[model samples]
Target: MDCGIILPSVSPNSNYFSVHASPRSPCIMVRCQQKEGQVKNNHHYNELPLLKRKRPTMINIPVDRSLENNNIMNTSRVRVQEVEVEEDGYGVYSKKGISRTRLEDRYSANFASDAHGKSKQALFGIFDGHGGAKAAEFAAAKLGNIILDYLRRGDKSMIEENIKNGYLAADEEFLKGNATGGVCCVTALVQHGSLIVSNVGDCRAVISKAGVAEPLTNDHNPSREDEKLRIESKGGYVDCCNGVWRIQGSLAVSRAIGDQHLKQWVTAEPDTQILTIKPDFQFLILASDGLWNKVSNQEAVDVIQPFFTAGSNKPELKNACRKLVELSISRGSNDDTSVMVVQLDKFAH
Candidate 1:
């Protein structure tokens, strides 16, 4: 699985700040040193869609720790549905959840290549759509491109600033139709042996380094103390329904890309995390709430690590992804689910 790039996997320096946690909610928040009476809205956050009470009950699914030591061939319950993926220094896979009739989840993988077909840079993401799929569908196709355009400017100083602008631009562009619905997003960008992760809402990103799960994004649920305070400060209220805290008694997440009607409270700005790919950074798991709600971070990592470590040839990330989706379904994930497994060929060497 060597792609000619190997990096250190731990001791990451945290440089990511979001409008959501700060002023709060995005790779999109822009803080300013303003005087009294002046406010800056650099964070391109928006309110969420107000609908009937929607809370997916969180179910604790116990992981069989012994499964981690077994070979993939021995795992009879898991099937190998390996998609014929075009490899450019990475292996990837994703699937729709078992609960939804109309799959609203969407994702994308973009690799910047040279003439010989080797990849120099890559971007991957997972988007969980609620209300409808249009917003999720739109962001999957556009966010990466927007960021790439910014990088082409050759201004490392503005990399973060530009990426934030990209989210804002995407949000602005989508709102042109005054469209309905919202999407939670988690994205990873790999370049110069560094991984930049940005997220909004409950969709998450986690990297398994040295066989340990290191979380890269925060789940922006209304129940989180920080989130509750932010919403309250805005004169909004958080209430528990069916055992889940929701903003304004309707939306479950505090930040998202759309939800035009709830813009005042729910934001689109994503929190960001930057990590230099370490030697032990094996792979990354990016998924929607359905998977996260059902699978604990360590459980998810422990399940997949054995596959990469024991296999003779490179472990198929697609198979690992499929097994994870299956795990979530078996664990009672009652919403649309999506997962992407990224084999960090560069780091695993």
Candidate 2:
């Protein structure tokens, strides 16, 4: 069985050259198999001339490693869904897990520059969906823009309020769609040397300060005392199911953007904070529970430190993000993993 771009099988008798098939973009895999009689009757191979080589030869072909790496990262059970890199600052990587038959993780990364081409602001988000991918996909595509629009209308002092409003606004829009399921979210906004971080679910943001890991947002799980109290106060219940605590015996997260049935208890109001970007800040990591459940915050920072700490204007952040997700998968996480890495120094100015 072969997988790649949709193409008809080549006739061995007519084709004098080799045809190499590779996936250029996200594509479907189709298996083309010949029947026993077809293979037995085909004499095309015998008609082709063969030349013996004394040794091996290196073929000089320009290759796009981004595409190649994406393919190489996929396994029979796991699929690499997305790989995006902005050499100027950040990169993102997401993969479907072995336990899940589909990918339910989505992400967004946007950077704004000033008239002089200087980096002025950056936005990063990770959305992890449960029940379905619709909520995550909707939030990933629409939340950043809504938040940035709010930020444009306010000053740094109002960053917190703007971010919160953005989350609520996006939630309202999504709820109007009558979508089922919900998405855990984490967003990082950088502007005027201040890093604003926000979250409403298990998605997390962590920053590396001179090689030390500092969490920017806490997971809003039903297991938390505050979260549990909030849910119960709203006439909801929290129960432990199979060793995992869940709200109302349904969702594991206490807050999110959708899940209309649980909207009253599972609010979309994000906890927001602002931190001044300093020289000590190395980089920031935004990821879903897929990575956090398996990899510790310090472990994640340590694994990617060498890449950012290297004195290079263009660090290999793409590879760094890829390695982090791979590490999580290796650690027995059977959930979709998404990771985004941003070099702090790039936006420090």
Candidate 3:
């Protein structure tokens, strides 16, 4: 338990100093002479005292090597695995009535060190799926790897290209497996105080800076004029069959991955943007439409502000995701809910 460096030294002619002994304790005390740099242990001497009359100085004492190693191992083993999930029918049907599934998949990686040995880089992502979990799982497993690989390849402008390529690749893989689900994806890579974000579908990415929520990616929906124009221009029309424009009356989102039917008319090219993380940039929020459908970006940021500002004890990011999902359910959002909150300071090495 006493795992530390202790220095013990005595003069050639020292008076008798009593040392205490514990019952059957496994303790080793190493004594070293400053001039000789030699080490020795006195098994019989339970306590070694330092006298003011001694001219010899002990630079360092070797404590229990095993104890010190154990302490270091324990410290290095500390890590955080933050994740959560929830699902509810909300007075709709029987046990098999609503097949509502909430999938929250996230990935966060930070460089242990930088090239100049001063700054570090961090990467994060959140994938929220609606129709099925395959898309979300796919994005969670592969997007971060793709982005990191691109960065490692030393392509300065490859972030956006890599994101677009990753989305398209996931779409292809999903279609090959006969999975018909669609997902809203968002990714952020932070390097050298800059952030590059890419998003598709309704899952949103919002940056909270200076107490204001600024959206990083626009929602690709039928209601947006830009999306509407893009969809219509590609020979696609958004028809309001159930009070909302649906692609060909089947898909709700005008843009998404793995919607083969929709993909025929609409592609999965994500909207990408690069941002600078100034002192004002506090955090970023990424979540599926389930959270955004019931809560605005500003409202969601407000709901999770306390967690981010209250230091590092709480699992703010995961808790924020859970809270957002709970709020969506309370607000009668039947769709699956997922949220991801990332703090800039947490990634600042």
Candidate 4:
């Protein structure tokens, strides 16, 4: 991945700052110094201060900006896209928080099938990373496949058990990577007119029923009574850091995919729920805590409801996703935000 950073000149002779991404890691390193023999060329050079005399050239890395197919449109800060699925119409939008330079949130949406490609299943998920983005990236790339693999190789009759095991399997696989930090997740699986929703940590899934907003997954925060008890049972304590409660006064959520340091208290087993698609069910929203920290479940649905009132098309869904991200940022949420909208009507039997 290519990232850009701008640095200010510190001395009168300093001409520019050379910035490049580190090959060993994701960090961007900058070398700021005076260009030995460069002459000032701008007419206003004499009037401007050393810092303003010469500006560092910025390199813009263009991401997918197309509206057709499944490509994502990425600006310097935001990325929006329509998922390339044959049946469900869903859109994804994400923005890096103002507090951070790199975006840590990751998402996944696709269809899975058995060996013969007969049983098609839809999966959608959002992952919010803390400390680093590795955990989120790993989970986003692997979780869906792991779950689908269970259904393919294992007993399909015990769907809930299989899903729960699938989560544990993914968590175990992530731990083996020896990566730092962790990620919160929320996923939606659709098959046979059933919407199976699961979550670990604070990422959430909300559904629009008729015109009302209903939450499907409960956020797994230490503030919850059961979560608090579970943490304490593992000999971990929860403390109020500022206004938010955190597990062992370090992590905010009680469950996650990585965080090997706190694996004792931070479990990865998700809470899963299965809902039969009804006529009233309109659409589903999956987002990270960044959006929830500012927008309420009802408010989110209210904002998106208008976009789908006419019809759930790709462009309209993209607009709805963009609006939700913009709304969260406008409300002073500086955390990385990711929002996905899945039209449930198309999946209804």
Candidate 5:
């Protein structure tokens, strides 16, 4: 993908500032102040007055007219630098499905400052598209923003409200499409010293805390008594197939993003939970059923923890994600595969 950076234009009558991003480039901004004095050359120059030997005060003045018109007088420059990494440092890859017409998986991560100076918020997500890739893409692009917006708007005190609003917004966007609807989503927002997780459908989020793997969110499916009751109360019947409950012999999950026909019975809202972040919070793995089907949560955590303990960074996390997808394909998981991994320490400043 081609990426571009945008900068705002500078004003002529005010102090100008500009920021540029690149491996070796320095971010800088220049400020020019007005100059006053007589000058022989067109180029602006400052003059220093002589002082008395005993005690005196000195003054400086500009000597050029053109420099004043061009706003080059008494110019001051500031440079801000950012850490640079190699292109391969991100470590991401994709593969084609055996029978699927198109790739239906997506993953993304973002890092920014959190409440603590040495801590940062790391966002990781996995979107599994069912009927089409539109809903998945829509959720990948907009859900993060909606959640961040809610947090920035002072709604962090209510985690459930923030997650529900974000999921609903993404669902509204997907409804504009004409294709069948189905998307399983899982997200993790790592803040100061906590991990806030939310999920819909079977896509899972598991964390390795103190070498013990634990689920952060409940999976919404018709197999559960509560889920079955909720669906049946809406005049929807659950068909048991292979020990799993299916909605009207169609979907396996009772909750998801799209699936408009089953919207009345299922909900787009996800179950949200917040956990205290501890030193033992080693890593987090988020993946669709393609990977979860072949590997259990604890197994998934076990397979990736070695690399993380060996000092793997963002690149390692990306590699872990791709490896899960590959494992799914090798294990005869014909479904489209999506996987994402997030390392807490890598995000900390």
Candidate 6:
């Protein structure tokens, strides 16, 4: 990662400010465990009837540049495509927020099982940085590749364990740096028809299955009952300030990638969920808190559903992704916003 700080350098007369963030400015740390001893059953996902497979090939989605002429796409910042990773099974899109906050969000997606000479597998992740972009940036640049390399080593049974180790590796690597900041993250890994979703902090992953919306991860906010219990059990305290629940009246989340100062409280652990990819699964959504803070899960599904059903390609999907981010800004999200849309079963039928 480059050590140079990327500050806003847009021309004064320009209407837009170029946006940039990378592992260049993020932090890393992790501590995960599966909560057990709970007998209560959570409501199951809404399943949809499978329709006949009769659609044409889905279009190739690309980065949406509709805002290029807007006040946020100035020449001072490198284009989003410079960091986007798109291919056959997935597409990722990210942009700077309308806020003056550093462009501290980062994302990654990879779907090349052949490269590893194994059964098909895909990995996707999104990180939202705070303090600096170091944690998010570091995870974005290294996490998925680490998992992929681990898988290539022919040890696939302990998927959750392997992923946790990967997060730990990222955390250890980031702690070695001099940067001071942290990042929240969410990841979706699909292999052998199984989908595993893992997350820390508020960034989220939602899936649209047969027109119904299903959230894959929970936000680790300080106020969440379970999160609060976990923090207090660890000898930490939570407080409410100005309508927001914060850890020790400072951080808003209970878990994150990096925060050396709060390492004892703000854990790096991620909650994990596993499920088989059903035929009804339509698309998967991953995004930073900026978009979720302004949009509801159902609302997002409603806005992006039509595009998927219409056999949308790369550019169309890119537009859909861009539309969601723009919507967040319009809805008053002053934080950096990033979104990724992965059309499941895109190669099917």
Which structure among the candidates has the greatest lDDT?
2
lDDT tens readout by residue for model 4, 15-125: 754454435444445554444664533323332222212333443332333322232222224332222222237777777787876677777775755698654568888
Q: lDDT score of model 5?
A: 0.64
- TM-scores of the candidates are 0.72, 0.76, 0.65, 0.76, 0.68, 0.73
Put down candidate 2 lDDT per residue, 114-191, tens digits, no spaces: 999876887878888888788887887789989999888867567889899899999999999998999999988888
Q: Which ten residues in a row have the lowest lDDT in candidate 2?
A: 67-76
Q: Which lDDT value does model 3 have at 68?
A: 11
Question: What Cα-based lDDT does every candidate model obtain?
Answer: 0.70, 0.79, 0.59, 0.78, 0.64, 0.72
lDDT of 1 by residue, 103-196 (tens): 5776777667769866677878788888877788778778778777777874786666767777777777777868899889888888878888
Better of 4 and 5 by lDDT: 4
Of the candidates numbered 1 and 3, which has the greater TM-score value?
Answer: 1
Q: Give the Cα RMSD of candidate 6.
A: 22.4
Candidate that beats the other on lDDT, 3 or 4, i.e. the better one? 4
Off by over 4 Å in 5: 1-96, 111-120, 177-179, 241-244, 311-315
Specify the poorest-scoring 10-residue window by lDDT in model 1: 67-76
Model 4 misplacement above 4 A? 1-88, 113-119, 311-315
- Best first by lDDT, ranked: 2, 4, 6, 1, 5, 3
- Looking at candidate 5, what is the lDDT of residue 215? 86
Residues 1-349, candidate 5: write the lDDT tens digits.
2113224333445443233333333322323333443332323235222211222232222121221111112211111111111122122233435666556655555455546754356666777777766667667666777777777775557877877888887787777775576788898887767788899998888888866889887888888899999888989899888876799988899888888887888788898988887778877777777778887788778777776667535445546666666777788887766665666656533
With a 3 Å backbone cut-off (N, CA, C), the pairs that clash in candidate 5 are 181-259
Better of 1 and 5 by TM-score: 1
* Native-to-model Cα distance after best TM-score fit, residue 142 in candidate 6, in Å: 0.9
Give the distance in Å from residue 38's predicted Cα in candidate 4 to where it truly belongs: 23
Alpha-carbon runs more than 4 Å astray in model 6: 1-87, 115-119, 152-155, 311-315, 347-349
Could you give me the TM-score of model 4 versus the true structure? 0.76
